[model samples]
Target: MSTALNWLSALDHPEFLADRVSAALRQWPDGDAEAVQVAEIDPAIADTSALVAATDITLESSANCLVVRARRSGTETLAAVLVLATTKADINTAIRKTLGARKCSFMSMDAAVEATGMEYGGITPIGLPQDWPLLIDERVVAQDQIVIGSGVRRSKVRMPGPLAQQLPGAQVITDLAVPIA
Candidate 1:
């Protein structure tokens, strides 16, 4: 395990990563070098504030992944967006337009978990449905390293920030999130 993976106690094999994330990593440029470091965590502390308080990791080093849904002409579209914890995704204006939908909102928790095969509060940008867009906020990729979910509340994945840009269907967008007041 890499030093970045040392914070959390349990390290899962690459095979344990979300299916899509594992496959993407295998095909990524310099795959081994871009490999993500994962560690198990208490599901109770999986949320940002709790994770930071329990693990001593700073809030700025953590990122949040959200599932957004949009509907237009009775058709539904979904997307996964990654943003730093300090900011919120500009879903109404930026994301709705980007998705080309007249109406957009966060996906219902039930729908998200069922569709992604991942637990609530643990959904990640990795392993999302291939047809769905994966949006990476510019600010998130600007960091040197970031802690993100591992598709299960029991674990987290840490990797170089820019590595997210290499995932299948990823699109780095500027101003994807608005800084919290």
Candidate 2:
């Protein structure tokens, strides 16, 4: 939070959060919603590498969200996956096998943004379509806290890692991703 960003309680700043994300947060059980925070960032640096290099955020504390499409028997299924920045998602192996798909790949940027109602480079699992099963790597949920997209490129959201598993239909898959190797 140098000259460009100021972290604040996300629940207190609806403007900084995507409409869907804000609504989801408000629905969180108990008062856990207060545990999340947000900080504005230059959209140009919203990509993980640039954001990490520009701020105090560390790779371990950051999470990346990806939209995946798997196809089998001419049927396509879309899902959202989240992993820590230090690890690579095992989309080609674990995910593909899990999906029982003959082929699987990331959804195109345009398709992902359109389906998620989130800005590209700022997709988060929190407000994903209710039909999309969210796959979050176990490592991400084990962390003390994580910094992830707020469904908008203009800001990032921070929350306790365990909260991620509470998102609607989230599946905490062990070995869903491999360590950065």
Cα lDDT, all candidates: 0.80, 0.90
Candidate 1 residue-wise lDDT, 24-91, digit = tens: 55565565434577777778988988888788567898999999889999999988999999999999
Q: On residues 1-181, what C-alpha lDDT tens digit does candidate 2 reach at each position?
A: 5344588998899798889999888888756889998999989989999998898888899999999999999999999899999999998899998788999999999999999999998899887888888899999999998999999999999989998998887999999999997
Q: Which regions of candidate 1 fall more than 4 Å away from where they truly are? A: 1-12, 29-34
Best by TM-score: 2
Give the local distance difference test score of model 2. 0.90
Worst 10 residues of 1 by lDDT: 1-10
TM-score of each: 0.88, 0.95
- Candidate 1: give the clashing pairs: none
> How many steric overlaps does candidate 1 have?
0
Instruction: Please report how far candidate 2 places residue 6 from its true position, in Å.
Output: 2.6
Error of 1 at 64 (Å): 0.7
